[model samples]
Target: MTRKLNLLLATGLTSLMLLSPAFAENMLRVSYPEDPKSADAQMTTDFYTLPLNIFDRLVESETTGPGQSALVPGLAERWDVSDDGLTYTFHLRKDVKFHNGAVLTADDVVYTFDRMLNPATKALNTDILTFIAGAEERLDGKADSVSGLKALDDQTVQITLTKPYAAFLALLAAPGASIYNRAFTEAAGDQFGLTPETTNGTGPFILRDYTLNDSEMLEANDDYWRGRPKLDRLLIRVVSDPDTLRMLFESDEIDVFDMDFAPTQTPYFYGADQWKDHIVSGPRVGIYYYNINQLKKPFDDPRVRKAFQMSIDRQTILDKNFYGKGKLEDGVMPRGLRCYAPAEPIAYDPVKAKELLTEAGYPDGVEINLQQVSSWSSRWSDMNQIIQAQVAEAGFKAKIITTDEAAYLAARKAGDSDAYTQVWSADFNDPDNFFYTFFSETGSKTRGYNNNDPEVFAAIEKARGMTDPAERCKLYQDLTARIVDTDAAWVPLFSLDHSFVVQPRVKHFIVPWNGWSDMSYYNVEVE
Candidate 1:
């Protein structure tokens, strides 16, 4: 009887061990090419905004659907929009606390916006705040305070807008509107945005450890306002080389990989009988193009700019570099977007280009230098080389200048380059951000290019001021046709398709239209 009892006990112990949960420090590792420059939520670059968007928000929800797109119960449970559509009254969630055990309140929200609008903070999205009644004046140092913003009580906050901006809800979704812990920012001094270690926000994860050009580690925030994250830990590794990233994915070193795979190479991993089940592809919300410096000589002439557009073989480039994974972009907006139009793009004609160059007084073949910043996925060095060869075929001697990523961005921002590649991802489901920024006189002009064309500017203004969605779409379509036909400031290249390879064990991974792969809903289920 004693022997039988011992045998039963041993059998029960073995069964319990087999059914036990995976406590081996569950971590979901992701690999990407670039490292984030800062954890500062307000940075305009996607590097900072991507992670910050996942970590914090004033309101969050999807667009292009029936759901309410804006100001939907993030830190604030509900909010009231005044009859005039100017004042926003927010009712804060009662039982919410920061990662550090401090209760979140209206004071924190007020502090976050005040600091964001402060000139000293140098927030990148200051322009977005212009909708606030006195935010523009305050940011310009013409006002004593942001009179449009006020805290009514510990649980209520009110914001006043100067006008009924159509993209206001989308703007709120941006990182510039994220609420930050006052204590953390004050204590970190100058190093606050550089890493997640010093920065604290009301999110589901906290930055535990990170090494530049190496890896980042995030641990779940048990005190998150919504609830604790399912995964105990998240790891992001920086693999600057795409080839290496692919190899790592094949070797199973990383669980997920993103980037368009070459057609020739796809069969090896994504064969019908092999990894087909793991590969996923979808449309992305991004525009890739070359910006022309309008301030530069020759290119300043619209005819010369139009001639340059006619010289490049966009289809060939897309086929070669993108592996036919993307479609040629004729305008700023891609197909499937609300405002997209099937307009005519400049055809490749060396003779016409030469004639235009001669007309611009560069008869002996214009000598121009082109600069392209290095990117991990695009292999920009190779792309520049091909572009050089193509442009030379059109009687133009082109020189390619390459720089490291950081220096390249600085030069582009300072308008120090004659021409450079640019990519813009939509912040919201609007065409205004797309066309306005690239062509508007006041928007980012890394290329030093400005339309100055009265008709073009008027069309953009009309679209911006229009509140009706159908009217806005029609105006934008007309604007896109004008820009493409005139070759106003850029050469629209191709719209890339986002690709991702995930491990079979991962579930509920969603790749949204914005190219944001939301990992919050992801969970691991062991086979």
Candidate 2:
């Protein structure tokens, strides 16, 4: 950071805290990639980072090691599951309270899930709650509430699933599953998460203030259940331009920028002495793959899909596309997960690819289109062009198309595109997130891919209910092989390690296995 910016921050710290005499201590400023779109946690997917820190969930994933997290209690102090594995009862903490001073209760938990499951609410990631008994019924508007969820008393919430699901706790730990104040939400109406004033959560920090397209400030909640935060205040500002973000970090205007810097920028930042000490790189639970749309003619045929999958040279792409910053992923799960069983990916063979295409009745090669984001920030467009050439080598005519991020997502979700580059981050620690999310009928809306095969569906469903670890392991492995090797539904790609640059003053911040470690409860002290 520059000397001028350092002096300015020191002066503003005192002036800003004048409004609240109690908050004139430690301050941490960060440069964020984009502004949050919504305040309601369940309405959006993983795009909103504030909700992860502002609103506490029933359970939270505590970072253990790089690319590793363990499920721990959050609002619910303790929980127990019945021997049948279908019933789960949570004991809520009586001492916890929302930022509004309302006591956290079992009723709030019930209300949160009910609101998310309501057909009218149009929650974005309600697929996580599909295992809860009567969830389907409630979502279908056949019932007003989820029959499986009940408040036994003021401090307890019991949930019964349709069957034994091992990852139920992990699913509850997701950000979208965080608890909120029902009274406050209803009062905020349609404008709940639009501004800081309308958002009330039960987390470590309070929404101090917000300035659209500029920055937002957060003050430590003095009455927080986890005690006061180490830092008195957190100032998050937007610096979307990569060059501008790099300059701010260099000028000492920002303390840390956790968002992944551009691929080219990452190497330069790591090698520079003034910035090298602040670098933190760790494995993340995310995969960037190409989603195939079977709604199209050639992609609809299993033979065509297999032919396309068999032709790709994954090694060259990983080394060239990502600059060797990630690991080769052959299956759904990454290298760190327990269910992970790595196998050699299919070798790239253009000759074999052509033979398969000929057998599939496309002897003269077929025309297919590829889609990607219009932005070059993440290098999605460049990756698309690279693959377009690689596939064209094996009797496939590939056309590269670009559109804005939102339009590209909408087109993919509508199954209107032939193929599109996509990314999926782990919501929990289970293999079910990979198998159920991408390949099962259970995740039809969430995946937006073609997965109507009956055998694959049976394998996924059977794996979900397998109580024995040995059996579950066997089934998960089988399902992974079917999806990646045999079925070739998705073109498996590389998994990346999130790279970040922190200021030297920042201390004791750990990275989460998932994207953006839970900064909510970290001991962030700025010198």
What Cα-based lDDT does every candidate model obtain? 0.67, 0.77
Give the alpha carbon lDDT tens digit for every residue of 4-104 in model 1: 32353345332222112342135566765677766666664456433552356667544432111323567777788776667888888886776566777
lDDT of 2 by residue, 1-527 (tens): 22332344445453343223233236677766677767688888745567876889999877788887788999999999999889999999987889989998898999889889999889987988988999999999999999999999999999999999887888898888989888988888778877776999998887766667777667778888988888777777777887888877677677776646445687677678877777887887877787877777787777788778777777788788666778877787776564777855766788889888898899999999887676745577778778888898788899887778778667656656558776777777788877887788745434567767789888888877777877887788777787767677777787888877887778876666785433453467776
**Which RMSD values do the candidates have, in order?**
7.2, 4.6
Model 1 lDDT at residue 488: 59
Scored by TM-score, the top model is 2
| Total backbone collisions for each predicted model | 0, 5
